[model samples]
Target: MTPVWKKTPKPTELIDRVTQAFRLAFGYEPTAVYSAPGRVNLLGEHIDYSGGTVLPFALPQRTYLAVTPRQDRLLRAVTAQGDAGASASSSPREIELGAIAPGAVEGWLAYVAGVPWAMAQEGLVSRDELPGADIAIDSSVPLGAGLSSSAALECSTALAFDAFAAANTGREPLSASDTGRTQLAIACIRAENEIAGANTGGMDQSISLRAHQGSVLAIDCRDFSTRPLTVDVDRAGLALLVMDTRAHHNLSDGQYAKRRAACDFTADTLGLTTLRDYFESTPTLAEAHQLVARWEEQVTAGMVDLPPQTDLPTARAALRHALTEIARVEECLALFSTAETTEQTWAQLGDLLNASHDSLRDDYRVSCDELDLAVNAARAAGALGARMTGGGFGGSAIALVSQELVPTVAEAVASAYERAGFNHPEFLLASPAASAAQDR
Candidate 1:
């Protein structure tokens, strides 16, 4: 049977594998093994940076870390073959932890080293205060699948090292600290930005660190606050089909930054700190759009300098995508809150998703041919709705379909990809990605 990256099989089959890899890499057993899940953004894309809201849930697919705390401050890292955080290899490779520094560690382990480096820089722990450890990793989360494999890898390493630090000094678990998950998420963001060199909007880190079991987190980018919403995905006999188009996206490229710059330019031109701020002040979308139009008039009249590196069209589209995606989150909530959600209700939810994709694809211009193909194929296979998720130059598209049609939709997508002569893609059903328990 295939091993899933979810919170199943109690002690975790991946942890067992990671433990064996740890022993094989070093010479003894690990201190503790920990894991963290990746996530799928159900609604809202590229909106988090504009201080808009997003709905996302952690996936069962996750990343893992097995570590042994050391009195000697030597950081030795190894990863199992086929691990999410490392290159595919026939044997493990080790990196000394002492060599780690911000903007230094590259490849898959940069994200791992970044956690401790970030924490130390923040003075949460001094450089010498951090104990050296032998760390080994294994994961089922597929890298570059637009499923937040980076966040999962970072969080798992963060929690593992945090727990180890606590054990050595006898302090409350990091989760019990007043700082809690938010602080961890921030640290992960720092690592991703400053270390991993991925300038992201923080939705991935927040959901991976803060999402609850069996729930989607509604995150307000305004203040990084989150609310858990229990989605009855199974109640409607529906499944979220994740289609990894294998069209990997490198968000560090100019495209992701270009879109973000446009959003920021729009907000600045409108005299607001963020697009969310403008919408918050305006009572309705029409009024906000009207106000934005006025601002564009000012720019055209040379009454104010237009924000740099963005045209009026791109700026307008960015703001529109941000506002509409936030609205979709509310629509999804209302649909799920009805007295009795039926298949038809799900179809309505699907329509909202379709509208979201149209906006992202047409207005935001994030969807590429492969992503469009995945969405079209899933819809052709009878998906209630389908859309591309993640940073979106190309990564993955998600489809909402009845549980029974999962295979059919998946097969259809695969066949379509083959017909297009693209690489064969991977697919999986949606499941809430939960954090691991201490005892379990």
Candidate 2:
């Protein structure tokens, strides 16, 4: 595992630039800066929202915010990466407290405005009691790359505001007993979920909140609980490769909404509050199948009639596959804790990955030609196992390979993709990285 505290100049540069901008715009120096890291799901996909287990690690990429309170109820923001010359070059605008609403600001400013409005709505902060500040935002996370970039942005902003509020008012911060890091972390997560309209599980925020060096966090999204599992890959000369398909996928898209809706329907149909509730009391595959059957019947009857061309049987099979995949994720976590050798771990991990892809391809129907090609090419080129990693409708895939074969495997996949007339994909070698922390 790579050390979380690797000396990187990016954060230092971001802090300096933000401080300079804050001093120039607000005529005051920022006392503190906070940062939150984007995360990648190493195993579980679409499972967080399903109320299942997820294993996510913070990426080195992060969003940083430098803050200083103001005497007025005006909020001003400047971006490290400016928008067009107009928005980027323009001096920070003093946004009226009342005017900050959905669509109040365009582009990334929406997030800047939305954070304050959300906090106010939750009574965490009031417009009348707003902490006036000039905040400068900088991020290295790739936007729309299926990584949790939005979460990083929202969490960092929330933390900066929370820290400023606590300092200025001399009031104990939310979840802070004067200075409890754990409490502050929870507060940050709440700010993002309640204030930012993200309807997200706690995975991103928790990883951002409690990431450590040389470990991958296996998080239970249901209770916001985490257990750090050390990833010792170097002994085996293995590399975790993340391939960016460059295909677009949006969380707010209808496909995501539909999958969420299906999970909800599954809970309601089973007379349960959530899928987690249903899974806990039922242990056998037979019982699981029965539950899925009942839910499928309810869904089919209530929703649009299954199209004649559509295979309802396959659809039911897909739901069962998802349920099984959820169980497999739990098993995989156990394996991660006990597996002795890297190859042993890779084999177990790869089996699960292959199972997941089969489910996505046949059951969920979310895999695309490009995704399949990448997975196939990697596996054919000596990858132990590979699968599409995200909410897959054209996102990226991850492949498990030994270090010696990485170059050959990546090249083979790219070549296969090119020959198929698809755009060549960008491949990255990533490992379990540290989660978010306060930048001093």
Candidate 3:
């Protein structure tokens, strides 16, 4: 078992390391550098594509991109972390900017090559007009943790390209304004979906580009509008502990795609634009149950078709998770706004977190044994609330605990993993941090 805790490197340290890697790889200094943080979804899971609102905050762990524009049309990329799994090739990968397209690049380089292509598709820039760059990638965000490390890579690359475009046209940096950040996020999402072949929703990219320090960003996937709620964990005497099960998950696996497809199928069967169209405002847990019941009634009445690929029970289960998770997100927002968090409020928040995990584990069917153990152990150790964050399956779970009990909760989870003969879980203390931006 490895160490129980791993610290995310500070900005200065990461910046310096990336700079050195850039120089060593390209044999010249990078003109500029940009960084984007991986994200943790505090609440609301697997409903973004269904147009549900989610609460996510940026992590201190980030991916950094260092670039120097090239006069020619060839784009080249390299990474400092050879086994980061960001790319298949440990050496630099190169492709003509004009040749970049969907499936043009494979493996990790697809993420690197897709940004310029997506920017062109979005009309933010033309592929022929885009400046090629020698790029270096470095990151502290743990791979396969469901912490949105892929988004961090896409977003950092997007910001770097955005800066390149601004400088080429003698315009102000597009990353400077909220609207511009939204555009950059859009480009990143397209790169992930069309180029990388990952069917991710906008939640990850939106939070990576738009999140603020000490606040969680509430995102409406329907419109991609955002509201930041201040979270003072220190003031509330709480610590947000993220425990990585060391059980890696790949979203490109059919698991994530199947869930998204089921949700889409359910919404289409109901004749609603999205499951969220069924709710004008946030629903109560009772109302969420009612919504599920309504779906069952409709199914029994033969109002919708159940394709062989998606059975009635699976559709209903998916809907149940989406509706209930939406409610949990709303509850969190209300709690954050009403007053400073006291012990009672913290407990209430914990209950919602627990319920969210249950829905994901039972109905959504995404929790693995490792995730369940991590959550159960943290709760037994006196965490206010514990749930698996991100896309579930096999990634990380977060526990809300009293600040003073952080060590105790971490040790308990480690002990449980040890007893189960599972990999020793790694831990991180999560705080709301700044969104993606230029580092230097």
**What are the clash counts of all predictions, listed in order?**
5, 1, 0
CA-lDDT, candidates in order: 0.76, 0.67, 0.87
In model 2, what lDDT does residue 361 have? 76
lDDT of 1: 0.76
Estimate the TM-score of every prediction: 0.90, 0.82, 0.96
Tens-digit per-residue lDDT, 68-115, candidate 1: 888886677776534333454444444455666666767676788888
Candidate 3: tens digits of C-alpha lDDT, residues 104-211: 878677888898889889999765458889998889999889899899999999888887888788888779999999988998889988888888889999999999
lDDT of 2: 0.67
Model 2, runs deviating above 4 Å = 1-9, 17-29, 81-94, 101-106, 120-129, 171-199, 281-290, 294-318, 339-342, 421-423
Question: Model 3 shows how many backbone clashes?
Answer: 0
Q: What is the lDDT of candidate 3?
A: 0.87
Q: Who is ahead in TM-score, 1 or 3? A: 3
TM-score for candidate 3 = 0.96
